[model samples]
Target chain A: MIKATNLTKQYDNGFVAVDSLNLQVNKGDIYGFLGPNGAGKTTTIRMLNGLIEPSDGSVTIEEKEVKSENALVSKLIGVLPESHGYYNWMTGREYLKLFAELYGVDKKRIKSRVEEVLEWVGMAGKADILIGQYSRGMRQRIGIAKTIVHEPSIIFLDEPTLGLDPQGQKDIQSIITRLNQEQNVTVFITSHLLKEISEICNRVAIVKQGKLLEEGYLDELIKGYRLVLRNENPTLEDIFFSLTTDEVGGSI
Target chain B: MSSLIKKEIREHVFSRKGVWIFFAISILFSGLTYSFISVKELSLLAQVEVNMTFMKALIGISILVSIILGSTMVSGEREQGTLESLLLTPLSKVKIILSKVVGILVFWLIISVISIPYFYALTYGTNMLLTILSYLYLIGLPLVISFSLLSLAFSTWISSSKNATLLSIVLFLVTAIPMFLSTTMKKSGFAHLVDLLSPVSASMLTLKDWLVNRLGFFFIFMDSLPVLCFLAISIICLFYASKKMDFLGGE
Candidate 1:
């Protein structure tokens, strides 16, 4: 279980990226974190992963406070950043093996685990090739493999489908669904791709300008929007615009 | 952390640049030493001086390599957008920093070790074991610390890899300028001040003296202390930087 209470992150330049946000993510739920370009989605994710400190708030994963250096939290969480940078010199197998060690898997199991994850991600054939030689799609596949190598209970994917071909996007989407359903992993994914979220995520939180606009079960949000559209013949996209605009105008 | 450290070593030590740099340093030292040996007009003291000069060259080369490796450590990760990915993992910032330092240090040790056989072949029958060991234990440790710390410090301040590289080079030159001037001017006041203030100059001085004759404990102690301090400072600075890292706001 993930719980965030009044989480706030303020920069030295006085920009508040995440404002007094509160949230909870239970086990086995695929949660989507949605926001505009500069919304605090990434910041909130960073804080949850313990990458950066929150200015005036707190986060607890499985009832444990997210400290500055909590290795245990890292052990239980797998993260796929929107853009992944790896050591170009290493082969895919070698790169995955590195994370496996950090995750403290048994030494004998490292090789098999690496192979399994690589094969699962469909990059087994290219496992021996240097990462520098990989295509963008191939890199993304390997990035996902690295994240799952530890078999974390929770997974955080930051725009995991960005810049991929349609086929690559399909492959990742399927993998994410399997991980959440079969493995029962709690997934907290952030993306600009609302369509993808609408299709896969069970719940979503729409954030704008460091504030939460609305959050709940996806079906509920869509239903609420549909009720408004009954009198006006508006598409889901139109409903989204209206809801966001209403929040903006009222808050301003 | 151990896993990250292992990965760092595998990526860094086995890479093309790592191998090439090692081979290049070996060739450089061997060629300079062999050329000196071929000259028959030099006295025994002059031969020792020549060997000492080559050792100094090795020290400088190692420092350069450390800076090159250290500056690219984090900035390169940022450039590739991997910093975010790594940060997402359960790994803490301190683990990442320590793993990086350890990996780079291991590479430096390997390069230093490879130079040993070449030095032995060149010096051939002189009682150079003591000098070599001293250089390895005393001069080498401090040299690695100084360069690693300097590079880490620079990396923390700059986000751009290109800018980090440029800054590292500039800082290297600035640090070395005093020693260069001191050597060229001999016992002048400016040289004295430079020799006192610059770690590189002090290191060169200690290394040069050690190569020619047995160095006193006081000189070795004084020389080694500053480098150790630099290493500690680097750790502290990295911790502080990790604390200050804000992914939400970009400059």
Candidate 2:
């Protein structure tokens, strides 16, 4: 579980990336964070993951402070950065094993765990190939595999499906679904694909200009939006455009 | 921590570039040693002086290699987009910096090992091997490590590896100014001040005292104090820079 209170990040140039934002991600929930470009989504993720210090307020993971380098907080959460990079020299299996060791997986279990995560992300067959030679989809799968190598309770995936083909996108979406439904792992994913989020995420939060526009259960939010628009059926894309657009009347 | 160190070594020191660097240094020492013993005019110098020259060249090359290694350690990771994942792990920033320092140490060790045969080849008939090795480990190691640490601190603060390396090279050349001064310029007040303050000069002075001048241990230790102080300052600067070490790298 994660909680952020009055979180704010303002650059010295007087630009606020995230302004007094608050968010809560419960255990075992697939929470999709949606925002347009430069909407402060990645900044919020970085702050929550403790990769960067917030200019104001704080974040706590399972009641532990997230700002400092707390091993417990690190153990509880895994993160896949938006522009994730890999060591081209390392094979997929070696990469996972290295992360497993860094995450403090038991020495005896590291081998099995690496294999298991490789299999989980559907990278077992290509596990021994150098990352440099792999396709983008394969690299993305390995990236996901690295995050769960140590069995973190929660994983933050920033644009996991970016730059992937339709099949690759589907593969990643299924992996997210399996992780949440079968393994009961919490997923906090960010993306521009509202349709994909609608398919997999049970809860969603939409933000624009560093401020939260909407936050609630997907179905409840949709139902509320449908009533407001006087329409019986409306897609998440419609709701996303409605909330994020600056027009007096939303495009929907 | 060991995993981080191993990763650092594999990524930086155990790669193709690392192998080439080692190979080139080996060839350089071989040629230098052969020229020292066989060249008619050069071979006329005393064996101790030859040994001293070899040691100086070894330390100079070692300092350059260490600087290159340190200058890219952090910024290289940032450029490659690997620093964030490493930071996300439980490893503290200080430990990350320490792991990189260890990687540079491993590089210095390899350079030290490669110079051994050359040292033996030149100091074959004399008791200079022990003295040369002493200077290598004592004055050379500390000075080389200090330069690398100072560069590592620069790498932590600078985002671009190219810029960090360039800045570190400038610093290296500045400290090496005393080495390039003429005998007359060496006696000038400014040169004297730089020689006393610069760690490179201090280490060189310490080595000359022990090897050529054959000064007492107390005098050598006093000469080496500036080098030790430089090492301490570099260590402090590196850790202080590590406190502000971020995923973005630059200030």
Candidate 3:
């Protein structure tokens, strides 16, 4: 479980990347955070995960402060940043093992845990190959594997399926769903893919220009939107466009 | 901590950069050794002089390599997008920085080992071998580490590896200027102060006392105080700079 209260990030150049916003992600829920480009989605995730400090307000994971140096927070959550970079020189197995050790996995269990994660991400067959040689889809899988190598209770994925093909997206979606449903792990994923979010996330939040526009259960939100639009069956795309668009049919 | 250090060594020492530097240093030492053995005018000099010359080259090359390693340690990870993951780990920032320092130290150790045969060959049939080894570890080790830490501080403050490396090298050259100055110029007000303050000059002066003048260890240690001070200052600066280190780098 994670809670952010009056969270805000103001840059030195007078740009407020995330306004004073509140969010709660319940345990074992696949929570999707939605926003267009420059909508503070990534910034919010970074704040919650303790990668960057929020200018004002605080984030607590399971009632522990999400400070940068908090070991408990580090153990509580895993994160796959939007622009996650790999060590091209390292093999997939080596990369995972390195993270496992860093995350304080039992020394004896490191090798087995790495192999298990590689298998979980469907990278077991290619474990020995250098990450640099992997295809983009393969790299994405390995990145996700790294995120969960320590088996953290909560995982934050920032645009995990951004550049993937349809099959690649499906593979990642299945992994996310399996982690939530089977393993009972909480997921806080940020993406602009409405269909992908709708397919996997039970709860969703939409934001624009650093402010949250809506947050609720997906079905309830959709039903509410359908009634407001006077349509019996409206796609999430329609609802998203209606909510995120200005009166002049321009993105706000 | 050990895992991070091992990763650094693998990424750097076993990489092409490490291999090429080792190969080039081997060739340079071979050439220098051959010149001392075969060259007409060079053969006339004392064996200790040739050995000291080798030691000087070794120290210079080691410092350069350490600078390169230190300057790239943080920025390279940041540029490659790997710093974020490392920072997200439970490892303290100080431990992360210290792990990088350990990596540079390992390289220095390897290069020092590589120079052994050359030092042995040059100091053959002389009583200077043990003394040379002692100074190499005592004087040279601290100097190399000082520069490495100083350069690492720069790397933390500058996001671009190129700029950090350039600034570190320039700073090193400025410190080494006293070593290149003429006796007359060194005695001048500004140069004299620099020569007294410069760690490189202090190191060279201590080496000269040990090898050429046969000065007592106490006297040599007194002359090497500046090098020790520089090492202390570099350590302080590095820890201070590391506090500002972040996923994006810079304060």
Candidate 4:
């Protein structure tokens, strides 16, 4: 479970990325956070995951307030930022082990967790290969594997499927879905692909210009759609586009 | 912090930038020191020669390799994009910076360990053994570590590895200029002022006084004041760097 109350993030240059926004996410939900470029989606995720401090307000994950400098909080959450990079000289397995150790996983379980995570992300075959030799898709998979190597309670993925082929995207989507459905792990995901988000996420929050526009259950929100689009089965895309067109959602 | 330290150590050992040069210097210095001492028949003269040659080798490698290791460690990681993932770990920024500094210092220490044979080959039966130990532990080790820390601080502040390398080399050269000015060029008019600017220059002059002029260990320790001050400054640089660095960018 996660709750953000009046969260605000202001840059030093007087730019407000996220302004006094409130959000709630239930446990075991695949929550998709959607926004256009410069919509403060990554900033919000950074705040929630404790990578950066909020200018004001607070984020509470399962009741504990998230602090940027809290190492214990980091153990419960795993994050793959939108602009992440990996150690090129390290093999995929070694990289995962480094993170697992840093996360304070049991020393004996490190190898097993690495193997399981590599298998989960479909990187078992190339686990020993240097990351410098990996293809972009392989690197993405390895990055995701590192994120879940410690089996954290929550994983935050920002553009997890970015730059991947259609098949790669499908593979990542399946992993997200499987983790939520089978493992009961809470996922906080952000993507520009409304279709993929709709396919996997049961709940979503849309933002534009750093302010929350809409948030609810996919089924409930669709049923409550005020836009009388001709398509009876309007996807999340229609809602997203119409909502983010102006400074705020005017017609949705 | 321990995990980060281990990772850093591995990176230094596996990296090619500084370690090879370190080995070459160690071997070359040892060979030269051994040969220089083997030809001297006079016991007292051989003793002085042993101390002088060993000190030169240790100090030479300390200057070059420390800068090389310090410059390469952080900037290389940042350029390779590993710092981003490193920051995402539970490791604190201070721990990361300290680990990087420690990793390079370990390289300097390894060089020292490898040079032990050279020191023994030259100082086998000499009274200079205590002086050698004292100088290495007090003077040589601190100088190497201070240079390493100085370069690491530069690496942390600068994003470009080339720039960091250039800056670190400049740091090394600053001390060398004073040495060259006072020794090679034999200019003393401003050499005193120049020596005041460099612990290395003061160190060289003090060593010349000790081995060549027969001054005792007290002078060696007393002359190390400048080196100790630089060590303190190196630590302050790390403190300032920890405050200024942004973990996400390593800027």
Candidate 5:
């Protein structure tokens, strides 16, 4: 389980990227972090992964301080950032192997695991090609493979399908679904794609301008706001549009 | 740490630019040695001048290559967005920096080893130990120092690899200007000061003199101390950089 308590980040210029944010994610849960661009989704994820120090507050992963640079924490969590720029010189196989070794997997297991992940991401045939030659979609696939090579209990995927084609997006969606349901991994995903999030996320937290506007199980949130007019029935999309528009107009 | 180091090495060795840089250094060093040997019956002044020029060129190349390699150390990741991915992994910043340093050092060692044969063939019979020592002192040590420090410092200060690359180039040129001016105006106080501040000039002066005549141990130690200090400073800068890496996206 991941729990963030009063988490805040204040930059030197006095801009609060994250403000007194409180969040909790339980095991086997797919929690979608939804926000527009520059809405602190990335900042919050960075703090969760122990990449950036929070100005105030603390995050605990499995009851251990997230700030502590422990090997166990690294082993337990897999993170795929929105943009993963890798060494262009290395082949996909080599990249996966490198991380496998870092995660302390046995040498004997490294090759098979790498192959398994490459195939899982549907990039097995391109495993030997240098990353520089791969397309953006291919890179994203490799990024996912690298993140899951160690089989971490918790996976954080930031914009995992950012540059993928529709087919590529579907492939990643299935992989994410399997990872969550079958592997029982707690998945924390951040994206601007509301439709995708609505489909896969068990619960979601909508953040705007460094604050959490709403968070709850998807079905519950939708049900709470569901309305039946005597002569008109509004679709979920219409409700979504109205809520966001109302929020923008200074009413939540 | 070991795993990261291995990854660094693999990246460096396979990199297109890294391989080309090594090739160029080898060819340049070999050409300089050939020219030095081909000139027969040279006056003492001429020999010293030629040796000095060769040493300066080696130091300059070392600095250039080091900066090129080190400049992209972290900024490249930021630019490519790979840094976030790496940081998200469970590795510490210290491990990342150390691994990169080790990788660059390995490259330095490989280039240094390759140049040894050329030096051996150039100064085949005349004071072989001295020739090898001079190369190490004058060329190898300064290259390591300048590259390590400037690269680490630039990586820390610059937000993008392109900026770091441009700044490093400018800094290297500026640092080398004093030595270039000193060579033209030989015996001026300005020359001496420049020589003192410039690692290339200092190394050439100390190593060349030591090669020709026996120096006391105390003098040798004193002369070599500055280079050691530069190296120590480089390591410290690397540590500082690791601690200061923001990880979060910065404006």
Candidate 6:
């Protein structure tokens, strides 16, 4: 579970990235955070994930504040940033092992944990190969493997399906579902793809220009948005259109 | 912290560039030692007199390698987009910075270990080997740590590793220039400061004392204050960079 209260970020140049935005992600739910380019989505995520400090307000995960001593908060969370970078000189297994150590996984169990995560991400076969030799999809899977190597309870995945083929996207989506259903891990995902959110996320929050426009369970969001529209069966895209503006970051 | 240090050490050890640099220096050291010892007109004791020169060479090479690693560590991580992943981890900045310091020193330690036999042969039948060992700890350790921290400051402050490297080279010259100019400048506060706080200058002074004047252990410790001064300044710089500079690194 996570909570953000009046969370805001402002730059020295008088630009506001996230402006007093409030958000909540429930336990074990696939929560989708939808926004367009520079919509302050990534900035909000960065604040929540403890990469940057917010100018105001606060975020807490599992009752722990993400800003103060979030390194401790990081112990319970795994993150796959939008532009995940792998150590190209390292083997997939080696990379997993390195993160395993960073996450304070026991040295004795590192080998098993590395293997298990690699297997979970379907990278076990290529675990011995250098990441530089891996395909983009393979690298993405290995990135996910490293993210969850310590079995964190909450996983934040940014644009998990970006640049992937249909099959690769399906495979990643399946893994997301498995993590939610089988492992009972909270999935916080961000994406521009409305269809992907509709297919996977149980709850959704739509934001534009760092401001939250709408948030609720997918069914409730659809029902609420449908009341304003004639479409009986509202798609996520339809709900998004009804709730948020087309204007992006600069105008706001 | 140990894991991070080990990871960094493994990277350097496995790198082809590191291997070539280490051995190339070693081969050059061997050639220099053999040539000096093989001079028919020079006595074995006279050959051992070059101990200070060989020790200087080792210190210089070690600092060079350590600075390269330290100056690139943060910027390289940022460039590869791995810095966020690292900053997101549970490790503190102190732990990260200290581990990098230890990592670079460990690499230098390995390189220094490989030079021991060559140095021992060069100093056979003299008190020079003992001098080398003493200076290696007193002079070598602090000197390398100072350079490593200074380079780390550059790495944290500069987003581009190339620029960090350039700045480190410039810094190297900045520290060395005062000593060079002091020969012409009178004993001003500036010249006195360089005399007190420049390791390169102290090194030249110490070696001169050993060869021409009688340099005792007391004088050696006193002359090495520059090493301690640089080490203290480097500590301040490291602390500042860790707390104030952006971990994401930038231009």
Q: Which candidate leads the pack in DockQ?
A: 2
Instruction: Write down the lDDT that model 6 would get.
Output: 0.82
Write the candidate numbers in order of decreasing lDDT.
Answer: 3, 2, 6, 4, 1, 5
Model 3 C-alpha lDDT per residue in residues B54-165, reported as the tens digit of each score: 8989999999989989999999989988998898888888999999999999999999999999999999998888999999999999999999999999999899999999
Predicted candidate 1 versus true structure: per-residue lDDT over A136-167, tens digit per residue: 88998898899889888888899999888888
Better of 3 and 4 by DockQ: 3
DockQ of candidate 3 is: 0.79
How well docked is model 4, in DockQ terms? 0.52
DockQ of each: 0.61, 0.82, 0.79, 0.52, 0.64, 0.77
Interface RMSD of 5: 1.9
Q: What are the lDDT figures for the candidates, one per model? A: 0.76, 0.90, 0.92, 0.80, 0.76, 0.82
- lDDT per residue for candidate 2 within A115-216, as digits (tens), equals 899889998999999999999999999999999998888999999999999999999999999999998999999998888999999999998889888999
lDDT of 6 at B140: 78
Tens digits of per-residue lDDT for model 6 on B140-193?
A: 788888988999988988999999988887777667666467455726777767
Q: Supply candidate 1's per-residue lDDT for B233.
A: 68
Best by lDDT: 3
Candidate 1 Cα deviation (angstroms), residue B128 = 3.6
TM-score of chain A of each: 0.92, 0.97, 0.97, 0.95, 0.91, 0.96
| Angstrom error at residue B211, model 2 | 0.9
Give the least accurate 10-residue stretch of model 2 chain B, judged by summed lDDT.
B242-251
TM-score, one value per model: 0.87, 0.98, 0.97, 0.88, 0.89, 0.93
**Model 5 spans > 4 angstroms off:** A227-239, A246-252, B39-52, B134-139, B170-178, B181-197, B247-251
- Model 5 chain B lowest lDDT segment of ten: B41-50
Second chain only: TM-score per model? 0.86, 0.97, 0.98, 0.85, 0.82, 0.87
Q: Write the per-residue lDDT of candidate 1 for residues B60-152, one digit (tens) a residue.
A: 787788888888777777776767766666666667888888888898788778777767765677887567767766767666666775676
Model 4: clashing residue pairs? none
Q: What would the per-residue lDDT of candidate 4 be over residues B70-152, giving only the tens digit for each residue?
A: 77666777776666666667777788888887777677777777777776766776666666666676678888788888888
lDDT of 5 by residue, B1-251 (tens): 68788877777755676788788888888777766766564323344455556556766676777788888877777777777766666677778777888887787777767766765565554665465555575546655665566675677567877777788788667546665673557457866665566555555556655665557656765666656566666678767767777443332
